[model samples]
Target chain A: MGGAAPAAGAPLVGANSSGGSLKALDGRVRILATAAFALATVSFSHFGPLLIALGGAMLVARLVELPILKTLRRIIAMDMFIAFMILMLPFTTLGEPLFFVFGFPASRQGLVEAALIGLKANAIVLMAMALLSSFEPVELARAMGRLGVPERLVHLVLFNIRYIDLLYRELHRLRTAMRARAFRANASWHACVSMGYLIGMMLIRALERSERILQAMKCRGFTGRLYLDGEERIQRLDLVFAAAFAAFVGALTLWEILSVAAL
Target chain B: MHIVDGALTLPVIAVGSAITVAGIGLGLRQMPPEKIPAAGVLSATFFCASLVHMSIGPSSVHLIVNGLCGIVLGWAAFPALFVALLLQAIFFGFGGLTVIGVNTANIAVPAVIVYYLCRRGVVRSSPQVAAIWGAVGGALAIALTTGCVALALSFSGDEFIPAAKLVFFAHIPVMAIEAVLTAAAVYLIRRVKPELLDAFSAASPDLQPVLAAAPEASLRSTQS
Candidate 1:
């Protein structure tokens, strides 16, 4: 399983990965391009187009200068979640028998469907990470704010980003304290009850911290209105990138339509 | 249980998206602006808590704790859970952009149901009783979430039936773990800071006087 714990403490505002030309594009443009890529990737079920989409995603990942091994590892970790589904589809779906494993026939259609889902999922995730993961979480949330996400929702996201690291540290401190007591977590009633108490303690502390934060904000003249940064005008480079991405997505869509009709 | 992109059919995705949007709208409506800080911090707490892995036999699993979320946040669990899902998708790619709607609906709808079912019991009962109710709510939320996931998969295609069954069965252990954790958490909250669970009632406009009176009594004692 992927380690979500490390990610929880990852620096949200800065990690200095946005070095490539693609990362330099406007956030809105990148967001739209990522969405377009996802939509186009998912619109097809054919193995041929899905392969093309995966290749295109890889190419984009290259353009974004993403760490290749790290990105591939992340994608493989995601695949583990669906591994059973992919494996089971071959035996379950009805179609011409491709082969037999343990006297059960694996259908050709099922194999195709499984491969298509895997490819489509990987393509979308790679392109999304390539295009948008470079931006700091705060930056992405701000872009979404400008993109007409409800102001309140955007504020909530911003606040979450602001506090996640702090809270994560708090959790770490608590866990460290537990470790000092030689507590070993296992599948036992005592372990579970102790873990439960840990969670409960964290939540109580969180609530009290929020109360203090509210008071601190009120002291600073908070009136429930948080001001997001001013928007950036789309640059010429952003327009060019947007138009190029649109053409690529448009071509993918056309290919999908023709392929489906051909079938 | 996080459905990836292109797995679900278009109609399932659309319906999921529509329901999620409506749920968020309702949740936001009930949340006053002054509560934003509280909601935001609590949401972050859940996000962090979900990252905590618990040992179950040979393998470990991270509990979603949606039952606890529902018990604490009420209708606002919708938006709070949505934010967590969104962050997870964007940062970790555990879920996809398009399927986020279905994922949120699967997790948060059960949370809301749990809230309705257990909130009254937790508020009015003793600590032990509230913890038992919390266990029920926690287990019930996971069961329902797994059911929703299976239903979403089945709706997508007959080919997904086995996968759906597998997903549901795989989560049975999770339900038990979450139940224990949620009960303990609720028990602690009920003992140490009952008002946190009473946030929904305290925030209700009509209940302002009662809420105000509770604090004033403490204020008077402090002054004296």
Candidate 2:
């Protein structure tokens, strides 16, 4: 959000999608925070603590200025899978006797497992939104590259992100062309074959285009390593943010360790 | 099917990431510099494949062409699929950022398996044989992927074993759809440019996939 009087959740449109000043707090720090939060929440075997962790993640997401609804949108997909698990797990888990559902037997441990999975998924997703979504892909790749990730993998990620949208558009246009040709595909084998033709055509187009792009790059003096511009150093504010997150991780880990020990 | 964030427990996540990291390392070592763009394009193709959905028996399912990728790209599918999976998570949130490791392993591991098992058959002169091999790779990829997803779920607790079995069962129709699609594509490619596909990385000459060895031997290739 811009200025002193901006409305709540109204982050300024161009105001660095990277969680603002907090987001600028170094890619390495952000990566660490994401991993630590994920590990801590995912380690929880109990349902009660998982709820607290989810609430804490939501609270942090709010504090760090991530859009809650947008974060929740990601959580929705996880919810579907979790829902499926809960529906199927209860009846099939072998454990101490629990209330019967339908004709199948439901186990207490199964119900707890379902609840933990749901809560852990939500919490981890929320933290990811708060910590990782802010940084752009290129920046994330760069951070990872610096952090000992293979250079080729980073370059692959860069190239993939750069071309992924373009290819998606190409696929859309191809599908449109098929539709224009009055092609109707359903669950039939004929439809599958038609779709296969479509994909084959798409693959040929993509390979040829790649060759062209490679030739163009070579013509313009290309090397195996793509050099990215910008040498922005981590500033003092970034250190402060990193320190805060580090302390948070320590506290969270300690709490989890104590809770598990008690259990 | 990409497993969303936090769906897996710590042990599964650690093992998955370790395997993925190793596989990508091998893939990079195997891939030559000139072939980078090819891998990138194929990665983008898989990325776009999500946009095109087809109806299978009772429901529609998006294509996860790790099998095809593995057949063509070999171990390189690790990095390619990893990049695709990451972008999917970041842009579409179809999967989660945190769980990219496990999802990548789940998809890419099966692909590499298919590559080793079926890449040879795919590059053959016989269209029917190639199609049969493609069908096997396609069916196998989804089956193994479903198993990986189920295993990841089961890691949360023993209570998930039945649910895991159900996940595998639910994908039986998807396996059929993948088989049909892959077989058709294999047939078409056999008719088209054979050089465009490679069963292994360009670096290796030992098993030089059928494409590299085809022209000199077969005068009659993919006619009609």
Q: Against the true structure, whose lDDT is highest?
A: 1
- Least lDDT summed over 10 consecutive residues: which range in candidate 2 chain A? A1-10
lDDT (Cα, tens digit) per residue for candidate 1, span A1-263: 31344455356323225637776677788778888788778888677778878888888778778777767777887899778888899899999999999999999999988888889888888888877776777778878878888766877888888887788778877787887898876657777789889988888888898888877876775655557665677888888888888888888888889988988
Write model 2 residue lDDT over A72-103, tens digit each, in one string.
Answer: 66568557745776666667777875887666
- iRMS values in order, in angstroms? 3.2, 6.9
Across residues B112-143, which tens digit of lDDT does each residue of candidate 1 receive? 89987898888799999999999999999999
- Chain B TM-score in each of the candidates: 0.89, 0.86
Q: Each prediction's Cα lDDT score?
A: 0.81, 0.71
Q: Considering chain A alone, report the TM-score of candidate 1 relative to the true chain A.
A: 0.91
* Regions of model 2 farther than 4 Å from truth: A1-23, A47-49, A63-68, A96-98, A226-230, B4-9, B96-99, B151-156, B199-224
Q: TM-scores of all models?
A: 0.92, 0.86
Candidate 1: residue A145 lDDT (0-100) = 78
